[model samples]
Target: MDLLNNLALGFGVAFTFQNLMYALIGCLFGTLVGVLPGLGPLATIAMLLPITYGLPPVAALIMLAGIYYGAQYGGSTTAILVNLPGESSSVVTVIDGYQMARKGRAGPALAAAGMGSFFAGCVGTLILAAFAAPLTELALEFGPAEYFSLMIVGLIGAVVLASGSLLKALAMIVLGLLLGLVGTDVNSGVARYSFDIPELTDGISFVAIAMGIFGYGEIISNLSQSDENREVFTDKVKGIMPTATDLKRMFPAVLRGTALGSALGILPGGGALLSAFAAYTIEKKTKLKPGEVPFGQGNIRGVAAPEAANNAGAQTSFIPLLTLGIPPNAVMALMVGAMTIHNIQPGPQVMTSNPELFWGLIASMWIGNAMLIILNLPLIGIWIKLLTVPYKWLFPAIVLFCAIGVYSTNNNSFDIWVVALFGLIGYGFIKLGCEPAPLLLGLILGPMMEEYLRRALLISRGDWSVFVTRPISAGLLVVAAILLTIVLLPSVKKKREEAFVED
Candidate 1:
């Protein structure tokens, strides 16, 4: 009943004329980003972060969140139809989804992806609504020690959840931590590595690095491929919606993915991507046994699991962010940035001081998800047609939008140059067989790690053992150590090498 009242209050705010319009706009823009190659949710949100300054906080967040998950919905269109994945999470979909398309089952595959995403999204929302309050209550009890421990857990989860060499993931994370150290020392009042540049004193711009690496980097890599190398789907779309049998087959996968996602989503970092990979692994391990359609050979379960996981992960990621004010992943980190921009400090206190923002954001999540389904289902046919567009046309336009988006952030042309540089680096990573996701995870977690590390040490009077002395912190550190050992083992290294062949 209290939840109902809060939701009602949220509706009152979300359903207003202006907020509804932003929601629509967000959904459309999100689909566009998802349809394009190279641009992911984080880059999309980061680029537009500056533009939302003039809008109301709730509406702005609704739009940003829409784009984030909306991409999850939109990415499958490209992956299934054109064999190009818009984001890393969608990569597994291309494995079997494109196969289904080749068999003239493209229409069923697209419809299954959209419908499954909708159902899973709705289920994920319900679970989030049920669990958020209790989790928030638990979060309220956290102190500085617990908070620092939680961050350590987040980093561990990120690397544990990342695919490819764990050593590579750890390397990226360490690099990210080092990059994060470039900014000013809050305690010493002295610049550490400013190199005397005023801009360097503020450290690397999140906008610069994220936009460059993910946004511009993707575009450059795409351009490096030959025009004839593009993947194209048949112009004839098979169907607009899935039949009844399809629904029956997909329900189980959705449930399984949702269950997996809900558990992993609360992890500190790599929630959505981890959930997607985990969902795929679960599907593989269980062996849908070529049961109905054969798993990964255009199987509906293939579409449903990852979609369910990604969406559920997107929804549950808010748990840590809203309750603990600790963003588990980049999208939630952007939300924190958004909230901070609005003069709001997100924490356990946010639920008490700004119940409207908290509940309203929660409520808007359901509404935005509903909007995504309504916005995406009918558009699958249209998106499939996009595959018919020439790579020459599509790649440039994508590159242009990334450039425009990055420039729009600070109205600075320097960002455009940075985007190009990162594009080169991104392409290099692709050629070198290094996964960029861990690097992103590291970059996102670096600053927080630094802050917590410094604070924990400060409390312990510069004792280096503070991280291992506290019970919670020690436990988390131990887990990280175990993960490192397991990942670095010879067998795991061999397995990681095999997976890179897929890249």
Candidate 2:
């Protein structure tokens, strides 16, 4: 009954005229960018973070959440139509989706992707609604030591789950922790690494870091690619509906993908990209029905499964951010920045203190999913038309918006320079084969970890054994250690590399 009441309250908040309008706008813009190659939700959200300052918190979060999952819906369109993945999570969709397009079954392929994504998105949101309150209750029991230990688990999970070299991920995390320390100390009010620069005193604007590393960095990289690499299929799309036979084949795949994605999405560093890959791999291993298409050669299941998984993953990845004040991925890290901007501290307290924002954001997701399905199918022609815009024109606009967004955060010009510096550094990270997601996670978690560690020690009078003395903290540390050990095993490392080989 309480759950029903909370949901009713959520709907009341979400159905407001202003909130509904922003949700529509977010879904529309998310699809537009998703249709265009190179631009992704991460960069787009980073660019828009500052703009959320003027919005009511619930409305702002609703819109941002819409953009994140809506991108999943739009990305499959490009993967099927252009043989290009508009979002990294859509990479697997290109294999069978483009083949379906090539075989003139593009309509069925697209319909499957859309239907799968919509179903999975709804299921994921349902899981979030059911589990979020319980998780918040669990989190409320945590003290400083337990919280610190939980962060350790979260960081280690990121390293274990992150693709590529373990050492590189660790190095990036350390670098981010160091960067996060540049601001004044909260306890002492003494500057640590400011070097007397007025701007450095407040530390680096995470908005600047996010925009530079994701927004500007991606634009700069996209600009370097030659025009020949960006060929679009321009073929006209006709039927948008899947046949009854196609629906039968798609239903099971969508179910499996949604389950896998919902579970994986809760793990740190396991987001839409991993969920899609895992779902595709599972579909490949499943035996095909008599007379059905093979794994990669225009298999409708291939399109349906990954699309469902990505969307599901995108929605469920919010679990940690909302429940524990921990961001599970780069995109969630940006969300942390957004929440902080609005003076809302994410975690258990949010549910107790700001039920409207919390439940309203959850309820708006269902509305957003419905909006995406409506927008994606009928507006396919419009999205395809948007693909025709040249990158040459798009890149400058993106760079300009990024600069403006960063500057507006503090109304300071120094942030523009900060963004430029990190833009180069971001490009350098790209060149160096280092992933920046872990770095962003570390930056976001560093200060919180420090505060927790200090509080724990202060409470124990500098006793180093406090973390292990508490049952909850001890369990968390043990989990982190076990995860690190398992990831370090040679056999698991080999398989891990193979899983992310698509990158």
Candidate 3:
């Protein structure tokens, strides 16, 4: 009954005329960015941060949220149509989706992606609505010790879930933690690592960092690659709706993907990228049905599962950000920046103090999902056309936008230099087999973790045992320990590596 009332209140707020329009606009923009390779929601949202300043907080958040899940919807289109993943989560979709398109089953494959996304998105939102309150209650019970323990679990989870070398991921986290230590010390009223630069006093501009690492970094990398072998499906799409047999094969895969994605999204550092990869890997491990196409061929289950998981994971990634004031990924970190700009602190109090913003955002996701399904199905051709635009033309405009966007944040030229510096660093990461996602997670969590650690020690008269003395904190640490133990086991480590191994 309380849940119903909260949802009703949320709907009442989200259904407002202004919010709906912004949601639509956001969804449209999200699809545009997602349809084009080398663009992503993180960079788009960072570039658009200035625009959100003037709007009502609820409207701004609704639109940003729309951009996120809407990207999930559009990403599959490019993957199926061109064998290019418009978003990282869609990388798995290209394996089978492009094959289906090659076989002239593009329309049915796209339909499966759309339907799977819609269903999983709805389920993921429902899970968020049902579990958010309970999670908030649990978060409310946490002390500084528990939070510190939880962050450990989160960092370790990132290492465990991240692809490529565990050593690289851990090194990135440490680097991020070091980077986060820049700026004025919270308690000491002194600068820690500012090196006497004024702009460094506030630490790094997250906008510059995000735009550099994800936006400019990506552009540089894409420019370095040869576009000679790129393929675009110009063949006519036969049918926009799935056949009866196709639907039967897809339903169970969607369900399983939704379940896996929803669960993973709530974990630390888990998001669409991890969920899609996991879902696709799981589907391949399942018994091959009689007469079913092989996993890398034109299997409809391959199309459905990762698409569902991607959407589901995208929706549920909000849990940690909203309830615990932790960002599970880079996009959520930008959201934290957005909320800070609006003077709205994210955490347990948000539900009680700002019910409309919290619930309205939730309500807007459902509406946005519906809008995406309606928009994607009919406008498939338009998105397909977008793939033909040459990178040379597109990348310069993106770089310009990123430069202008970074400058607008603080009206500082130094920030532009920051973006350039990090662009090179980001490209270096790409060359070094390192993942930046975990680094972003660590950077966002580092300051908060330090604060909590200090507060916990202060409360315990500098006794380190306080973390292990509290039952909840101890249990969280135990869980982190167990996760570390399992990941370190030789058999489990090999399987973990193999699960993420790219063919």
Candidate 4:
């Protein structure tokens, strides 16, 4: 009964004229960027973060959330049509989806993906709404020691789940923590690493770092490659609806994917990419029906399962951010930046403190999912036409937008220079095969972790045993330790590397 009343309040807020418009706009922009092979949700969201400064917090969060999941819908379009994945999560789709397109079954494949995504997104949001309240209730019991121990678990989970060298991810996290220490100490009047630079006193701008690393850095990487490498799909797509038989087969796959993805998304570092990869793997290993297509040759189950998983993962990734104030992935970390900008502290208290914003954001996700399906199907041609734009022209506009956005944050020219410097650093990370997502997590969580750790020790009169003395804190530390041990084992390390390899 309380859930019904809360959802009713949410719908009342989301149905307002202004919120609906922003939701539509966000869905459109997300699809546009998703269809363009090189532009991804991370870069798109980072570039657009500045524009949300003037929006009401509820509206801003709603739109950004729309963009994140809308990309899941649009990414499969390019992957199916041109065999080019618009985002990392869509990479598995290209295997069977593109094969379906080649055989003139693109319509069924795309329809299965779009419809499956819609269903999964709704289920994921419902799960989030049901579980978030209980999770928040549990989080309210945590003290400073427990909070700090939880962060350690989160950081280790990131390294364990990252699809790269564990050592590289650890190095990135350490770098981020060091960078996060560049501001004035809250406990004392002394500056730490400011080097007498006025701009450094507040530490590096979050917007500057996000835009530099994700926005401008991506632009540079995209332009370095020749345009000749891209393959455009200009074929006419016929019959956008799936047959009854196809729907029957796709329904079960969607259910399985939604279940898997919902569970994974709540875990640290398990977002759309990991969910999609796992879904496809599970589908391939399952028994096939008589007369069904083989695993790799245009299987409808392949398209449906991953699309459902990725969309579901994208939605449920909000659980950690909303409940515990921990960001499970980079996109959610950016959401933390967004929340801070609006002067809202994201944590267990948000539900009690700001019911409208919390519930309205949840409701808006359902609206956004509906908008995506309508926009993705009929407007597919328009998105395909957008792909015709040359990269040379597109990148210059992106660079200019990023510069203007970064400068607007503080209206200071120094921020622009800061972006430029970090852009170079981001390129270095890319060249060195280091994933920057973990770094963003570290940057966002580092200060909070330190604050909690100091508070705990201060309460314990500098006793180091306080962390283990608390049962909840000790359990979290044990989990972190076990994760680190698993990641370091030789057999597990080799298998982790193998799992990340593209088929």
User: How displaced is residue 300 in candidate 1, in Å?
Assistant: 2.0
Candidates, ranked, TM-score: 3, 2, 4, 1
Q: Rank the candidates by lDDT, best first.
A: 3, 2, 4, 1
TM-score of 2: 0.96
Per-residue lDDT over 1-503 for candidate 4, one digit per residue giving the tens place of the 0 to 100 score: 88989999999999999999989988887777666665567777887888889999999998888787666677788788867776667878889998888787888888899998999999999999999889999999899999999999988888888778999989878887888888989899688899999888999898889889877776677677777865555565678798888888899999988988888888786566788888998898889988788978988999999989988888899998999999988888889999999999989999999999999999999999999988888887677677678878777777898899888888999999988988888888778888888888888889989999999999999998999999999999999999999889999999889777757
Structural similarity to truth (TM-score) of each candidate: 0.91, 0.96, 0.97, 0.96
User: What is every candidate's alpha-carbon RMSD to the true fold?
Assistant: 2.7, 1.6, 1.5, 1.7
Decide which is better by TM-score, 1 or 4: 4
| lDDT value, residue 312 of candidate 4 | 89
Per-residue accuracy of model 1 over 244-288 as CA lDDT, tens digit each: 887777778888888887777777657677777778777777745
Q: In model 3, how many backbone clashes occur?
A: 0
lDDT (Cα, 0-100) at 206 in candidate 2: 92
Q: Which of candidates 1 and 4 is the stronger one according to lDDT?
A: 4
1-503: candidate 3 lDDT, tens digit per residue:
99999999999999999999999998998888767666667767766676677799999999988888666677788788877676677788989999999998999999999999999999999999998999999989999999899889989988888888889988988988888999999998898789999989999887788778877777787778788756778666767898898898899999999998998877776557788898998899999889889989899999999989988887788999899888877788889989988999889989989999999999998999999899888988787777788878888777887788788878899999999999999899878878887888888889989999999999999999999999999999999999999999999989888877657
Cand. 1 Cα-lDDT: 0.73
Those runs of model 4 whose alpha carbons end farther than 4 Å from true positions after fitting are none
Q: In candidate 4, how many Å is residue 306 off?
A: 1.5
